[model samples]
Target: MSVQRRKYDPDFKRNAVRLTEDPDRSVQEVATNLGISKDLLYKWRRELRLKEGLAFPGHGKEALTEQEKRIKELEKKLKDAEMERDILKKAVAIFSKAPK
Candidate 1:
């Protein structure tokens, strides 16, 4: 049997992370009140701190900055070019062989 993963909206995640930021509330307390795991709340808070407010892009959502998007595009183009070059090399090797 397989277990299905639960999906939370970006707003919910952000709010949960925000709750963990409260000075008066312990992370465990907030997590219990929110009905989410303490570890998950900590992880979200860590990510939010690291990203400086940009966190939790929901599934299939694009949250990359302009530079990050450009880098991803370039990386993909480079991968495609490398694949084409490899195919061309293989084709050249095959055509250069002698047949009986």
Candidate 2:
């Protein structure tokens, strides 16, 4: 038998982190009340602090900063241009060959 992992939505994670931020509440106290591991809460807090608005991008989704998004777009365009160049080179080579 396997133990299933629990999934928390972005809102729940943000709220949990927010709860941990209360001046009167300890991290362990909030984690215990929320039924999550203290380590998990700490990790969430770290992500929230580090990523700010980009934190908790949800499952199967990536959190990319604006510059990162632009870099990704430019990388894709470069790859496409390189592929097209390769295909054109092959076409030129074939056309330049003498007919048998």
Candidate 3:
């Protein structure tokens, strides 16, 4: 039997991580109160520290890394170029068929 992983909400994770940040409460104590592993709490804190501006992008949305962002940008450019090419092709066909 496979052990199902639990999914925590963004707010819950944020709150739990915030609790770990309190100097008065040790990480182990906070983790026990939140019913999460101490390692998990530490990992979340590390992630929050590293991505202070872009942490927890919410459900159904991916938090892209630098390489992924660059790839997404390039893909958009390619799509725009393809659309322009199609439009120009149609225009050329229309003009060529018109009486000179």
Candidate 4:
């Protein structure tokens, strides 16, 4: 059994992909500057794009972390307070219109 070894400098690949993200730079130019195959550069670029917006490979984490959870709770309380104020205003208006 033989384990095939593939030699690749990931730093160059990462830099090439990062520079390629700039609309002003050409992929061919970045690939050449990074001294890697344009094909590999494109593959890395595609991988980075695909990886975006995903928190992890599997089992997405909660959108609200602990601090965010507290913030969301506070926001809910504020919204409820505003709604209660509106209700109180309507109640006062109704009472003021009633006869003595």
**Each prediction's TM-score versus the true structure:** 0.76, 0.75, 0.61, 0.40
| lDDT score, candidate 4, position 18 | 77
Error of 3 at 58 (Å): 4.5
Q: Give me the runs in candidate 2 sitting further than 4 Å from their true place.
A: 65-67, 98-100
Lowest lDDT 10-residue stretch of candidate 4: 53-62
RMSD from true fold, candidate 3:
6.5
- Candidate 1 local lDDT, 1-100, one digit each (tens): 9988778787898898877778999999999998889998888778778776457786757578889999999999999999999999999999999997
Clashing pairs in 1: none
Identify the leading candidate in terms of lDDT. Answer: 2
Whose TM-score is greatest here? 1
Q: Which scores higher on lDDT, 1 or 3?
A: 3
Q: How close is candidate 3 to the true structure, as a TM-score?
A: 0.61
The per-model lDDT (C-alpha) reads: 0.85, 0.94, 0.86, 0.72
lDDT tens digits, residue span 1-100, model 4: 9987545554555666779889998899987886667897777778657654332233334444568789989999999999999999999999899597
Clashes of 2: 0
Candidate 2 lDDT over 19-100, as tens digits, reads 9878999999999998989999999999999999999898768899889999999999999999999999999999999998
Model 3: residues with Cα > 4 Å off, grouped in runs: 58-61, 65-71, 75-100
- Which sequence of candidate numbers ranks them by TM-score, best first? 1, 2, 3, 4
Candidate 1 lDDT score at position 19: 78
